[model samples]
Target: MTTTTPPTHLPPPYAPTDSDSDPDSTFRHIITSMLNSHHHKFGFLIYRVNYDNDALWQNYLNIIDQQTREYVVLEKKEHLLPHIAWTPMEDREKFEGATKDEIREFFRDWIHERSEDRDGPGAGVDNTELIRWSPRYKACMYVNGEMMQGAKMQTVDFLPGGPQLHVQGKGVVVDGQYDEHDRDVLRRSAVGAREDFEEVEGRRGWDVGWMYFTLRGVHMVYETLCMSEEEWTSP
Candidate 1:
């Protein structure tokens, strides 16, 4: 819940744009811009921290009375969670016939319990806080062309004197091939690799460098990445 300020020398924060008008768009923009490499001298590795949706959904049912439907979800704007839907569970029997508003209320309450308003023992961990607080997505930067062998590894701190932004403060490239944000580059990868992109905790190196970003720093990086290729590397 705490945040560190970004270094002042970096470019100004990025202004909100219609380009990120929705959650899906916002998520995509964050993932895309951070993964883009302005120069071959810079390389990026990212790992997405996906929600344990299935397990969390099952936890929600513990509060429901009696047997409920196999699936009970409410449609949300988040594209990553499309399989979920909303429906009345056995708890509806209380009202004899749950009204539309009642069903919505029940669903809303379930959502709230997962994040806030439910504490103490057996309240369950807040999945929302887990998604928000835990580095949902980790990004690593390989500087000085370290991505290619035979090149000496070097570190680059985009925001210096702010927060430590290197993986263990040593220039090390994360092992394994990463899913590139560039569509063309991604398409060139083997179909199987593309189909089953690995999910990782970033304990290795993906969670290093720009892993944790402040609000201001995020905006700065987003704006910097969105800049023209020429502008990106300019002094």
Candidate 2:
């Protein structure tokens, strides 16, 4: 490879726009772009799991098995009447091998279906219930650590208004009119994580982490890295 000397003249600097100075606009654009891009890539929400145990290995195996199996199949034959035909009960499919676009459509349809299940067995179910039905979809980690008897450290917790004491991992507090829709979405995402953990790992002696949103959804996990308030009403 050839190396060249730099010229004395420099290029013009980037000029800041009105949106660049406005936190709301900047955050909105950045978050919207990220969400849409992720949605487009995975077609569904995909969590980033961090682990250092054998359980995670088992979870991976389960997911792989699901993806390679039949997309949907009937559980058992059911006949309503003596001359009636058997009805098929469709089972939900896994996310393995699914294109990003296909997953997006799947999530949209899943939300729509749950929202309209007003009078069925799924009545009163939240829109995010289906997505949280499996433990693999949750963002979480399994690790080992130790605390000394005289050790003292700063504590952190996530609340409805935002993270208490600190915003995400940044030691700064963001005081603003946080969107209500976004707050509710974040809250529900947190609830789903707890529900999944309780149902799946509670009996196995697993304990809740110190962090409130320890097992949050993938989007919430991303929120820790960026301070964007994109409305999730459309999501």
Candidate 3:
């Protein structure tokens, strides 16, 4: 049986013109709409790794830690974290015949181990905090564009089937799927966002801006997922 692929394409970086709505305003609208309609509690956290070039992974772990801490404080109420998962390209190729359930389990176990207290001395920093780790897989590119004066949007696409996080001014929107082609499109899309934004900035003579507001999409997904999972699995 043929499988359907998920839609994954990074939207080109856009700068508002006289005729365009303020990017920031539009971003806020999107976020507010998402939060008001979606039945999930989402939040974001940022972190830097002490060493290594894997900033994404480090950031992911940092966010996870933050979420965990929040979960503890809230007594696992309101905020729930998502199940962490990853699918390395090498591993996927090595086990081409692996079933979806098997792959999910593999990632689930990997995430659980990484989250365990034994991963390292600092693994469990605080029972009240959660750490953010990088996404399980790598994307071709992660494009972050300035949506407004202090706000930016990040769109990422990874290889194989995965999820896309849209970071807007008010909140985040996450959509997940399991399709290789969609993954490819998302990877390329992220690259496109980066290129498009860079080109606009160069042409307009604007300095590179700090990403804010919209960069929390991933964190939102993680928190919502975590909360939902906890509720579902709770006795």
Candidate 4:
């Protein structure tokens, strides 16, 4: 996918001045820009494990597979279908039955091997990391701050000059800075809305500004609200 260079002189991060103004517009702008600019074949796979309940896990997998099937057709993209990859925890063990710890170890090692293959010497310049984990599961592919543990979660390897967002379950959360290399790439496109808003509202009283406007903090709040609305109405 293509990326626009962030503006050279981006102001400090945005902060909200009032309750009514939404800050998530910034995130939407960034996400939309990334999607439009980058034309790569991007997709995601989610694997779910229930510590003790095999039936629940299987039900969840079937539900997700069915949903994915619908989404593939709707997107008119075949690649999006088999985009989901699932393996049950129970099946990971043989008849001798490896312990959960052993299975986890195997899973990690398997993932690392795949990552190495995608990024190794003969693998060209391409780099990739698989398996991002979060404490909670939310809707598929609509990740945001409210559904995650924020700072405590493991970070994913962000692609340079590509779409970068946190993935947990089926959702994508947009928070944190992209990797430093990608940050540099995005630096040129960075718009300084925070400073601009502060300048415009500098003359107003603190209470008035605070009551009437919101800074960058509003971005998460707005995103949460929007996602909530979408989930509530979605079939």
Better of 1 and 3 by lDDT: 3
**How would you encode candidate 4's per-residue C-alpha lDDT over 65-160 as one tens digit per residue?**
444344345334343333223222233223123322333343334333432233222112232211111101111122122222221212245757
lDDT, residue 49, candidate 2: 22
lDDT of 2 by residue, 7-32 (tens): 12211222223443344331233223
Structure candidate 2, residue pairs in collision:
42-100, 43-100, 43-103, 43-104
Candidates, ranked, TM-score: 4, 3, 2, 1
In lDDT terms, how accurate is model 3? 0.28
Candidate 1 RMSD to the real structure = 21.6
TM-score of each: 0.17, 0.20, 0.22, 0.27
Best by lDDT: 3
Steric clash count of candidate 4: 29
Candidate 1 residue-wise lDDT, 39-85, digit = tens: 10111221111122434223322212111111111112232222111
lDDT of each: 0.25, 0.26, 0.28, 0.27
Using lDDT as the yardstick, the better of models 1 and 4 is 4
